[model samples]
Target: LDPASGRWIEDKLPIYDFETLDDFERLKIFEKPLLAALSRKSFIGDVLGKPANERLYGSLAAAAIAVYKGAHIIRTHDVPETSDVVKLSGALRSRTSVVKEGRYEVSVLEVKTPQDAGIAMRNIGATKTGSEVMQEKSIHLVLKIKNLTTTEALIIKQEMLARGGDAALARDAVSHETETTDVLVMGTLLQFGRLARKLDGQARSLPLIAEMIRECISNRTNLEYRYLR
Candidate 1:
């Protein structure tokens, strides 16, 4: 790594393939923090014909995307602004919370799947059966659903909220001013499963929605090979 820029300076310095970088799971293999650099002198600034001093917003936007793409540390000249961007971007990537009092501490864990929760539970010597049951409840997911009837969106929001989860619906859906609205559903695997099962018994297009939710969860958990078949 170059000390001046905190990035590798090699023969291919001019070309950075961010999409390729994002696709690779370096953290899973090396257990090392990935540091990403966002600079005013980057190609983005060049494309905008902006000087270093005038590229702050572009750099901040890059930094936020970097965080969402799994960069643990962001190397940027603008510390205060970048810090806010990082925090917000990270929150969007996953919901996290922390609490500390004296020597006791509790925090919401970030697990990508039930398998990840199972591994963590095993490490802590939790019972296999108990772990298997709790694992599905431990991981959270956020799914954005598009093109739903306003009534469907409103029902989804109410159902999710009643199930200890939540759904964000467009304001027009709540006000019944729009025919269709988009919704963002947030819940654990167990809650989602329950929601799908409940929706299966509901009238209208809800049975179809239930099927879609089941397919979504299955696809998410096995995306690497789901398309191969």
Candidate 2:
């Protein structure tokens, strides 16, 4: 043991093949130095691009390491969820992002149930009144629904036009047209939230929201949204 660095350095060990996690665990326990070589960096995660809540386990491990390493700052979306553990360990600290908020208009175009979506938008507004900003844009909605019959699809189209949302249909000549909705929409961010809130009730709708929003940004269209999935 060297007193300068306060550690023992092991020189030899076989790298484990990751055919099985159990073998990796055994190798770490029996062969690799478990605790002696550890520091704050021990808990660094390899979780690039994972959605926020999915990183909870890694976040917990990371917080533990933070406490171990005397960390003063951690930026994450699941703040309230992680704060409890950090508090119990006496590592809680206060911080908030300080930046000027930007303004944008959102158009809410196609939603399964528009009324319910409105409720969710209201709830979000109430929850983040001061720190967040939102604007609603008036617009048209066009949809190309796949599963609907001719008559039922027409009814939905009529409803959208009556409600000021433009609704389109799948092209008749194209082979792949029947599989997806062809919607033309224009709206602001708040309207998009209203539409999203309408669809937010179902578990599978989250990806729809993410995809639509992603398209909206990537395409840079006043067209607002295009929901394929």
Candidate 3:
């Protein structure tokens, strides 16, 4: 409706126009059973009557439960607090060790025996241990390639998927719905390393793209370990 023209507009329709309580109630019909169950619980309404701090505690508990139940990307007005809850919940749930500092600090060095030297030698192996660790970890990477045909994108995607990783062409590129000329490659460090090696001897622009990917990986690894001061 245009207030300036004093005209009732009919061209655009509201997707969700809840004019009355009845309209809103109709939307909640599907969740009526769950709502009924919650209503039966006195604790639920009791918690709702509390002050902001108490309400926030309740909300944090709900958020933790949701995260434990496999929810990701929780939307919250209290970003910092909710982030702490989620991080704590994830740490409690997952087996992976959470690194407090980005890099470990060597406060003291007690190299008293030959075994300690051997341990150090093992730690500093011939190959880059950092790269090896990155490969072993379930790392995910997204690479965007521009100015590529659908066929070329599919070839890359197929190669990546065959090597236990996954890749995809831009949504429109697959069905030719639109003129999208890009490919998105997803893989771990090892899979990407293998792909780059395979691409090295290939003809045309593949080798170029491969080199670009290698450079990106190298830069990422360098950035990751740059905090080891």
Candidate 4:
């Protein structure tokens, strides 16, 4: 509905497929509250030249989109039907829990972060602390150490490989060309913990580097960005 014109915006109808929820995905970065009122009374019948009672399918489509786009509230004339759509769309949007194939059920788990891994572990009856620690093992991080001496870069790569992780350094580092190289350290939280501990016992700026790595991960885990309207 266009408030300025006091008329319905035909393009806003979900059946027309003009309005999209693409921006809603990016909107999550802002973390603002959203409320959507999607109901059977969207005036879609008028656009289709049909009766009011025949808009059930259009309403269901719109309601599915609302749920998938993170609507806080969904107003609907058909409560039970809309509720089912909400559940299905919400499940698909968040994660695909299960699929059936050849008389076998496959459970699909999405674990991009430690939080996601923790949830997955808990669902399988893991203890809370156990899940927490295991979740860290499930999460891998890559940190770039910039402006490092060739020796430091070589040491970093060797140490990471020793810990079952890996690091990439510039060619200059391997050739000992007296040039500083940036090292990309890749490891799970568990491997990183081991690396940091090992670095702590080493000499010459390695302890400080370990502390810096820990602090970097800590800050990332706790950081939250807020925006004012």
Candidate 5:
């Protein structure tokens, strides 16, 4: 009878606690993610046996699976970067959380051109701040809009500033859209991945971030906007 049983079930599901695991037990559970991937027929290639390569792919596959299966936490030593990546990806429809299963989606409306997208995002107050020119759009806004609403963003900023430490305002934002399903206020596209990996990995403030974002916009081609409002 553990007090945290409820949380354990929700975050680490399928099983709660175990004293020990026999070889068979270990293999069975370990195969779940591989089987999960096999079920999708989404990937096919060389399955190597070397520990280094195999383990690397396994970790990535598991991480992908965890995201696919609605995992709430991930273990990593690079929390800042990882969390930054997570933050950006979750920017899409982040205004709300705790959605029904299979309800995640993003709306993308392709403007007539990249310039059109830039104008639209800037109208909403998004400042271009990225690593390179990922867009010709003057204001390529990448905002996390799912885990929180615009109102929540304001509240969070206020609370954090009031509490001390600038943790609320994002230096950069990204969206976590696996595909198009549940949403509004979008154009017509979806993206997912460790987005921070695309940046220079140096910025950590909002003011300088605006400059970084402009650099980012200057580095891309099909540059568009992830509007905040």
Candidate 6:
């Protein structure tokens, strides 16, 4: 018995859909161990009542709703069917839209020389190139820096901060306690483009890092790339 709620307790076999389940018994039956069994029974009954091909429609519908609502890692026995449903749901959710008013375009610029990169940077503006227009939007990026010392990680963080972006190092990176860590970079597309330009020809690893960022920005579905004059 629960002292606070004044509910009676009982020890009995778990049952589903009782005409009158005392509060304690109802709670116990709804627990994972008993509920799982009840769900299996219900699923089997649903399958038996439906045609062979239509047996999984209800389950697939539920899976689709879950995917559309941003649920990840759905567990199911129907992998092929569930995979198709999830893929379709994700494709629908990732659809992009254009606004006729107060709209901005995101582009990636690749320059070989510092002079060219500087010229590209100068073209970025609010109305001209949409630079600094995405103050309300921030892009999160993660990069795995294998075998980099803490000093190098700090340098990356500082460089990112100097470019109007921020970066977070893995635990103990500043204390010189970690040999390697994943760096999380947060910024808009404009900031990332500037960072990439800054990284070019700076170091062997930095150029590679810049390329990785460029590739990711290029592949993003939400953004369209255009050449800068």
Judging by lDDT against the true structure, name the best candidate.
1
Residue 148 displacement in candidate 6 (angstroms): 3.5
Give the RMSD in angstroms, all C-alphas superposed, for model 3: 20.7
* Model 1 backbone overlap count: 0
Q: Which of 1 and 2 is the better model by lDDT?
A: 1
**lDDT, candidate 4, 1-229, per-residue tens:** 1111111565553322223332233233233565555454544554456665888887787678767866656677789988899888888777447888898998744345677677767767899999887887887899999888787778878899998999998876798975788889999988898999988998878898999999887765342311111
lDDT of 6 by residue, 77-196 (tens): 577877898799667654233344456754433232233333344455333233234332334444444555566667778888997778888779888787766777776566778888
User: How far out, in Å, is residue 95 in model 4?
Assistant: 8.8
The lDDT values for all models are: 0.73, 0.38, 0.53, 0.69, 0.32, 0.51
Q: Between candidates 3 and 4, which one is better according to lDDT? A: 4
Candidate 1 structure lDDT: 0.73
Where is model 3 more than 4 Å wrong at Cα? 1-137, 175-180, 223-229
The numbered model that scores best in TM-score is 1
Q: Which stretches of candidate 1 lie over 4 Å from their true place?
A: 1-109, 223-229
Which consecutive 10 residues in model 3 have the weakest lDDT in total? 33-42
On the 0 to 100 scale, the lDDT of residue 134 in model 6 is 39
Worst 10 residues of 5 by lDDT: 16-25
- In model 4, residue pairs whose N, Cα or C atoms come closer than 3 Å (at least 3 residues apart or on different chains), thus clashing, are none
In model 3, what is the error at residue 194, expressed in angstroms? 0.8
Question: Per-residue lDDT of 1-229 in model 2, one digit per residue for the tens?
Answer: 1011111234311111111111212222122232211122212222234544356666565554443333334444466866675675444432323344467445332322233334445555544443234223322233233454444344444543444454456665133435434344434444444544544443443436435644554443322222111
TM-score each candidate.
0.55, 0.23, 0.38, 0.54, 0.18, 0.39
Error of 4 at 40 (Å): 24
| lDDT per residue as tens, model 1, 1-229 | 2112212444423223332233323233233577766667444454467878899997887778777856788888899989999999888875347799999989865566677677778777898898899998987889889999988888888889989999998887788999998899999989999999889998889899989999888976453434232
In terms of lDDT, the poorest run of 10 residues in model 2 is 13-22
* TM-score, prediction 5: 0.18
Deviating ranges (above 4 Å) for candidate 4: 1-100, 103-109, 224-229
List clash counts for every candidate, in order. Answer: 0, 17, 0, 0, 34, 0
Candidate structures ordered by lDDT, highest first = 1, 4, 3, 6, 2, 5
Q: Which 10 residues in a row give candidate 4 its minimum summed lDDT?
A: 220-229
